[model samples]
Target: MKAWQHLQREPGSAVADPDVLQVINACAPRPSPTLMRINGRVVIAYSRTRAFIDRDAWEALPSDGLLLLRVWPRGTSSSWFALTRPELERTFDEVRKTRSWNSVRHYHFRVFPAALEAFRVCMTRDEAPFASQISAAEAGSESEKRGSPVSPSH
Candidate 1:
């Protein structure tokens, strides 16, 4: 599923191209994680296979707010997950602590295929961590807008 498509469906959310953030690395543009704002919170939306996830690029996202990852496994439907900055940091810290790198500069964080399901519950559950963080009024409104738990946009 396209990452921003979900955000676009949210009544009060604003979805914009990654260029809006103008994030670049060493003169080259980083990968996609369309910028979005929902319920007055910023969210970086990523839609890609595990292998394409760029730790450096993601780490560059705003220190506050969530990273919305739509990790699609090979030949399978995508799953939606929202990670707070702290949660993302912890995962990155583990990679650094363990030195789990494919090479000198490439490391595989725990947010890979094996851990995708664990993250899915972060945003797709009834009391979704991310959703619950919203105010009661917003929660009720959003729940009404989205009658079911956030599911993969297949």
Candidate 2:
């Protein structure tokens, strides 16, 4: 069975969105995205869905790669997760460190097949600048922040 099939059978099985599934399929090495909602706000958007895996599965995978995790609020729409290279040894460790994770009740990790070297380069050269831009825009004004939605936790 596909990983997604197994996910659907899990205890909290929420239907993965079609768009999310498409992105996951098109993006090599990344797991299918998981959808979730928190409080009343949609903190995490649909594009940020992620897959969850057990520790054993995580450890068995290749060492050099990117992993994406999605976290959601208990009753709101806001949620987020980390996408990092060099598989996270402990998902909870990083989650606990984030402000949004403080109130999160649901989450999953999505592993990506990427070389550590490439991932590092991408993060430093690509993602870092993009993140800075978003931060700057968000800091500039409430209107801009509201207009530019943050990616879902993952």
- TM-score per model over all chains: 0.45, 0.25
lDDT for model 1, on a 0 to 1 scale? 0.41
The runs of at least 3 residues in candidate 2 whose Cα sits more than 4 Å from the true structure, single-residue gaps closed, are 1-53, 85-87, 90-154
The Cα local distance difference test for each model comes to 0.41, 0.29
**Lowest summed lDDT over 10 consecutive residues: which window, candidate 2?**
5-14
Candidate 2 at 115: error in angstroms?
Answer: 22
Runs of candidate 1 with Cα error greater than 4 angstroms are 1-31, 51-53, 96-116, 121-154
Error of 2 at 21 (Å): 12
lDDT of 1 by residue, 38-86 (tens): 4555556555655334454355556766566555667997555555666
- The TM-score between candidate 2 and the true structure equals 0.25
- Write the residue-wise lDDT of candidate 2 on 25-132 in tens digits: 343222333222223222112223333333322332234322333333345542222332232442234433444444443334444311111112121222332344
Error of 1 at 86 (Å): 0.4
Task: Per model, state how many residue pairs clash.
Answer: 0, 21
